[model samples]
Target: MSKASDLKRITELRRELKRHDELYYRDAQPEIEDREYDRLKAELAELEAVHPELSLIDSPTVRVGDDRVEGFASYQHHLPMQSLDNTYSQDEFFAFVARVEKGLEVDGARFTVEPKIDGVAVSLTYENGAFVRAVTRGNGIEGDDVTENARLIKAIPKRLKGDSIPEIIEIRGEIYMRNEEFERVNALRSEAGLELFKNPRNLAAGTIKMLDRVEVGKRQLDIVLYGLGYCQPSVVSSQSEYHRRLGDWGLPVVEAFWEATGPEEAWQAIEKLDTLRNGFEYPTDGAVIKLDSFDQQDVLGATSKAPRWAIAFKFAAEQAETKLNAITIQVGRTGVLTPVAELEPVQLAGTTVSRATLHNREEMARKDVRAGDFVVIEKAGEIIPAVVRVLTEKRPADSEAFVFPETCPSCGTEVTQLEGEVAVRCVNIECPDQVRGRLEHFASRQCMDIEGLGVAVVEQLVSRGSVSNISDIYRLDYEQVVSLDKFAEKSARNLLAAIEASKRVELWRLLHGLGIPQVGAAAAKDLAKAFGGVRELGEASLEKLVELDGIGEKTASGIVAYFQDERNRAIIDALFEAGMNPKAPERPKEGEAVLAGKTFVITGTLPTMKRDEAKALIESKGGKVSGSVSKKTDFLVAGEAAGSKLTKAESLGVKVIDEATLLEMSQ
Candidate 1:
């Protein structure tokens, strides 16, 4: 982007984020999901990072939380609240312990492991063995004084029970809503004809932020003190001692904790914590491992972001069995139709599981999942729920195989699956399901990003026939939209303004929004760079596309085939006709080809750049990124555990390089 355009986008992002913060923090009402909000914040941070001079002082990245809500008086914290670095793999968790040991210059290190509760962090202050006040962790430096709200929690003691309590001390921990309490609250809301809470964490957060103390009390929120933020006279020598003091003082703590002597033992403790996770009264996403000794923690110190002595070991999602009631086909942003399993609601990983992604028909057939069959389901990474396998013993003898649909379920158009691909796509762009999904995708943070065009709004457009195709978005009549439910003068104008603003989108975003088969965010960027415009791409032969870095033969074929249809080309023309002229791609510099003939594979989490960023960097430097490790792979950019890919590369005799080495070589 040009300097002016970049500045404009940053300004827009700031405005949107501030509005969301108000809804989330003050009103206890969130407009977008957490993942969506994270995406926007990430984009804003990236833009600021790229253009340092353009960064605003009040940018969300530089700060922790938004300003305190009007009703809550702000309280100052003695110590800045810190967040723990997260790891999904056991190898990574062990690596973290190794780092701590290396930093402390010790051979064998002891650590404390406990459940990392999924809840809002709060600070409690005690004076003269009496509970003085409690505050939400607003921005680390200070917090919102939610004393009245915190007082409602029955678990929090008004006075200390033991003489071991210090005169002046502050304890930090989680204020989580118990799973039963969460259900009760939701049931009450349902009886009251109110919207049900999305998740336990959000419900807990919303409950704390509520101005009405009575409402907060009704939820029966609970608190568990974990660590000391500050103390008048140094209280404990280690984390284990601190927990002992908490238990002695009659303060609520975690169910259990393990003391480990080494990395292997620490991992075993983490595994033990995982076993205790699903059985807990409250939700837990991972295990928190902390250094036992305060002196060792002090020696290890902390980064600007997190403490070096601790790390979070996240468990792979929990699995549970449920009946596959039915299989539903969903048309994605791209015309690809995906099979989703309708399940008999069963509790798993802190939330009720109703549906699971079958991924594609191929996966469905591989698992031999059918309606009326009992299946094991797991949340892959505790986010997307997926069907793991079918129970052969429980399957009815009369149960038949699931027939993969050859036609679009919504519009009855014949779906086609291309050679060398699993995705079965609806060729008709005019399919209502495709149109709605595409519109939602186009307005997504990664695409054109028209704010206010969410799933609900898109549903209204599709159902009312106000918009039937992508180009119809630009032609939305103001009067027609305002006639739809929930739309008033202000919202109608705002949505129209957003739609108008999306016309000036980047070429890569436009390409991604178009949803070409086998083309994702990265492939879209590659195609955009190789071709000046959609017309140029539409005319490009397969040979020209295959020559580009990261553009595999399969992706090249997809692009060529996507444009082969007149309906697809017409949509491109219609977009231009509607004034949404996307910017052309900026070509790479002439002489910056340091990694000309290299093929790289990245695994695990990198120390600095993300995998996508690394891939982009390598591609721009005239190198290529392969999905898997093979003899053809010239370099494997290994990070941390590096996982099975690194092992495969090593066995295949493929050269491996760290991020540092790769960066040095590129330079």
Candidate 2:
């Protein structure tokens, strides 16, 4: 093909691919088969390879498909995305309506009720009918720049479809991954031996901040614009008109929107939404009620952080009464002791919940939770299963007040609760519970990433006394591992290989693997970046550590106390002597294109590369991968069977890309 013709063909191909992407990712309707989609992608890749000049950054063939981002830059919303005040009872709802009416100086004011999507809020800016930027509602003023990622979302139009496009438009909406899509993504991650995300919303939030644009292109994220931020050549005079016009601009508005004339009608609408929330593909936390008139909205104005014109009526958390059969203490990787309430198996929301976490001694005391007491359990954010309240009226007469355990349940060692902390912890480094917890943390996906060292293996090693500490994990023999139940020669070899591979882990991973209190993966990275290696971190004074951005006095004290422990010091020495070389801190060089500030999320199946391969490539370039898509995701890497992520990418208008193009760009 001639150079000009080739360029024309490439543009045509990209346009066609973008259309297909809109249908599949944004609209949740795919007219083409997976093979057909792949064929089109392959053709685009071939053309782009031949005429690299025609390959644009926003090209469908060039984005990362279905990879997660590392972190998000906080965006302060120009108009704060303030949460609305809510009421669970009819009286409060009526009172709120009366208050709104009184404040507006109107005898009767209509209210528009929309589903409160249980997702992250984001703002999208379009300039001259072309998509320009996307940002998360950080503190409600400034947000991370996620323009490239947002463009990948098929649901969000790259260019206005109609002539009514505003010169400058800032659209506000929720970015959510559907329940089924979240499950599918997590399942795929599990199959790939990666950590599963907790829920759809978190996954959505986590996916949007990725730096690798190619990875963002893959996840098929979506968005639904609900409100207008700042607009030039304004299209509407009222909030209701804005909602009506949003559909014309090819933006997805709330499914059920109603304008109620009074409190009764608003309450009725809220009730209807509550009942219908379960039917929608995405989860809704509650209903958002806003003043229908723009003039009236202006009259009511806003608070320092929230708008007086809008209010979010949150739904009461789903609660179920279950008998507490037993109480058990579990030790976490960081040696913090947690109380667990084993209950009679009860179905909650959609899943069977048999246990609920009792967050700490303080939470238990606050709730007056006791053994044999009938308790009400609820899922916090419909994600974590937890106990909310205790029913004193249903308490058995013989039941006694539950006391926090004074000793480690596994090792019979004394446990202590530190001052200013709610968690009572087992301080013994060699305690069997502590050892198992530490080993599990060491082998976790975020740490050393040993593939085969699952909870079963860790349990076996602890029970058999084959491993007494984190360092002893490196000393485990293949013969001993194979001799354990459910072990085979091949499995043992693979486990050993994974363990051996873990020895060369970076200093950040090593620090996280240490299972230090108050030190999370992010904090571990910060510490590594500051101290260079574990030895240096161990030797650093509390005052020196507290000077770091995220590390405070509490965290500093925790680190110092951990290093001072003789047993911990010995374990560190042993790990150092075991041929492990902690990586030195890498300083960001001047003008380095090290994915300076970006996040990514990967979804579905890539055609040519394994997920890990793509992740390694992104990380090598100084970018971070996350498990879910969110307003924060800079890119969504979408592939075959790309489910809700595509929809979320579309709804949020996150950038979506394929595999071959990602490889070419990485070079």
Candidate 3:
């Protein structure tokens, strides 16, 4: 290629890399695989090396990707949170070790090897044995302060325990979601018709930065502290000692740790971690190898972007080649048609994998996946199984393109793919598969908290034609339930009693269980609190609904559309008729609307009440509490150490009030 062409290609690569950096760091929504991203970065680095004059100081290769976001206060790190230089090749890893050892003028430097968890890196600060702040690793220098959300994570302790606590310490670690928690959260999302999160890492990253602490608390996030950032009166002299210190403080630490004398032993440790990581609760993508001695690490030092004392060896995603027997479409609770690949049993990532997700019709068409083709399936993030690629050369001679069904396989009703959407849906609400899905969702713990109404029982009820719709559950006869397979008299009574008890559940649960599109538990709670009951909410106008907090135009429209549907209205009427009187939230008195028709944004630590307490108090008196302050905000409830939101509010000319003033106004 000519110099001009190389320059043009370099420009294109920089643009692409910048875009991907935003997606991966700020948005937590990466389109390309990690290896592909690494390859692109490496290519850019190589091209820049060849043409030294073409290199830019602010290039993705030189600078760390910033994860800082608006709405949260920025926290300057005590010590810069630098990233580790990583490689997929063993030779490159060994070269890294050689560089480290050469810098220290030693033959074999002692090192520590631990699982490089695929998670959001964070720095937690503790002052005098008490946890004070948590921040993301944003651009090495500063990051968004996420103390409020971090406080809710049970794994993060509030105070230090055991002996030899430092006056001030900053613990560095990764915040991640467990595989089972991810699955549970996805199941809820799938049931509620919300888009499923791609992986545990993305979900955890997104969850921690969420403005709503209540919503963040719902998703379980775990943390593992292994790195020491900054400690006053430094006591630990080695990496192993640091781990012990972290553990002594009642902090969650890495599950696996290995000591290695050299690069070869470190590689062996990494291989062992690869074999054992699948058994870990959280996802581990690679092994982080660091110099064990603090003195050694200090002597080696770091570059502008990464540390010279440490490097990460990323393991390739575990994959297995399997025969694709067929492609099957499964109808979800919301009637979305999902195509699942049926594969011949093959061992992958320590599990027997016979199926993988094809994602959508667009993905299938893009990949040209066909039935009877030999396909490579990989466990993405070591949690979700997905078809990585099709081995076209090994395809059968008569292989056929898997055709998406034009009609719902369950009800034979014609399926329709909505414009601007990839999901093909069976809109028939009464479709057997959809019914079973809805029944299960309505009975889920997050919904009605119904006991003795698991998947098997729901399947039996649906298959026996005993339950047709959500309301049919309320009408199930005791004798009919008892007659089902394996159901004794005691089991029948329990099931019936549970169904009967569900009638008195919270209004939010009923609203969530209704299978409303785009409305999850949080939205349901907002709606329930604003409108008091389902009947009143159903009768609300779009203008009125949009005026409420958390109710956007699209959600208001969905609510209006739901109520306009005569079938849904009939279901509501039947529910009421069948003795299902859900408990409505307490509404404010007519004279207590002092803060009525106003938007308030709360910031910083309050003198008496917590943020959620303040939010609830505000909501009770006919006022709305928003997550972020803006020009539209009527008041900024400023407290101690009010951060960026307060400054933004002042600039925007929004009124600032103390918590005491807020209390006075509300009264």
Candidate 4:
């Protein structure tokens, strides 16, 4: 067929697919059978392939397949995202109410109480009544742009319902994956033999940040707008009115909001929300209580970090008592010793609980937790299982005080507790426990990302003495690796290749992999960027290091202390001599022309670029890509069937560009 004819057919097919996408994703109704829809999508894809010039940016076929970006670029918020003050008890709630009333110079106060969603907080920007940007709340001031991912949420409108579109509007809300969807995702992971996420929140957070927008779309993530950031042509004067207006604008707001006249009424509302929380599709950790009147809110103002007119009344943590069978100490990758409570197996929060983290010596002392005591345990944020308190009344009469170990449990070496630090750590770097922890941390996603290097492999290597230090991993022969149980030749080769490839990882990863105290991923990046290289970082003085952004005295001291240890210094030397890249990637100069006036949504796997890299490329070019797709998506650079985003893009008539097109545009 001629190119013109093919283009015409592709356009017709795209229009048909877009209509179906709107029917399925936006309306939650499917008019066509799955097979029939697939055929249409396949035909369109074929036509586009034959007439490459005809492929537009809003194709339905772009949702599921390939294109991947390297990483997200930083997006500064128009308005700073502030956290709300938390009120844990009735007294605290009352105090908050009193404070708000006093600030407003009123004898009484009214509050709007709504369920505090247990999900990732995000900001959505709309321009000319069309969806523009969706960003994660990163450090309050800056956030990761996730517009494509956000567009996948059917609840978030791509276009305003009425013609009365505000020139610019910012809506703040929670993006959550429902419990049922979380279960489905977990099931898929389990089927794929992958580690299951601890909870919906973690899964949602990880999924949204995925380089593949299609993967995020498949998770059935949803959003509910709870607050307004900046609204031009303000539609409402009070918090209650804002909710009503948001709902009227076809945005998903909280299901119910209660107007409490005073503290007593507020507490009552809180109790009501807690009672009703179990019935909701998503999880809520608490209730948000905010002054109802906008004028009152203005009068109350805000603190540097939180608003004085609003407070979150966190519910009491769920707790269940179980017998503490024993106390054990586990050394972390950094050699920090942590105490674990071995409990009699009991079920809590939909999982079997046998171990709970005691955090450190300070926490143990604070709670006065003891072995042989009936301890109340709860999952912190319904994720990490933790011992909350001890039931003194139910303590065994023969029980003795649980003593914190003074020595490394694995190597039997003396443990040292640093001044002003809560954790007591083993000084022996070669301790068996330390080796296992280090290996695990090294293979972690944020580190070397060595696929298939799980706890079992690390344990086998440690137990057999196949590997001792981090450097030993590079020296592993194929035969030695394959000798372990469940290790096939192919698996062994893959493992070796992964380790070999890991040597090329950036310096920030190497810094984090070192397990330095107080140096997390963010800090590692800062250190790497500040020092330029690991060797320089190792030799830098604490004062000089502390001068860097986000580097505090404690972290600087920790870095200095780590390097001062001859053993750690030797390990660094060995790794450096082993030919691992120890330098940070050079920062790219911000581009001026590329991605200008164009927005792209990356979904599924791409042949090139990690998600962050793709995001950076877009931002460097002066264009913005968001986590979710909305009416703002000028282009959805779909790799695979980019899931809900593909559907949404089709529904909104946004262009769905591909990786090749994206690359060409970037040039």
TM-score, structure 2 vs. true: 0.67
lDDT of 1 by residue, 79-171 (tens): 767767667787778788789888978888999999988788899999988898888777454568888888898889988886666778999
Residue lDDT tens for model 3, 1-667: 8778888778768767766776778767776667777788788888889887666322332257878764587766878799887788899998998998889999989999999999999999999899999989986666889999999999999999987888999999999998889989989765533446778898998899887788898999999998899999797999988988888899999999999999899999999998898889888889999999999898988765688899888888789999999899989899998888999999986668898988888899999999898999987454558898999999888787788899999999999988867899999989999999998888875578676787777888899998898899988898998887767888789888988999998899999899887676657877887887898989999999887755667779999999989999999999999999898877678898777778898877679876657877887898888655545589999887675567677777889999899889888
Least well predicted 10-residue stretch by lDDT in candidate 4: 61-70
On residues 347-383, what C-alpha lDDT tens digit does candidate 2 reach at each position? Answer: 8876789999888888888888888888899863555
Best by TM-score: 4
User: How far out, in Å, is residue 401 in model 3?
Assistant: 2.2
Clashing pairs in 1: none
Better of 1 and 3 by TM-score: 3
Q: What lDDT score goes with residue 134 in model 2?
A: 84
Candidate 4 local accuracy as lDDT?
Answer: 0.75
lDDT (CA) per prediction: 0.78, 0.73, 0.84, 0.75
Please give the lDDT score at residue 286 for candidate 2: 81
* lDDT (Cα, 0-100) at 335 in candidate 4: 79
Candidate 1 local lDDT, residue 112:
94
Model 3 misplaced regions, further than 4 Å: 1-113, 116-240, 246-255, 258-272, 275-316, 381-383, 630-632, 647-653
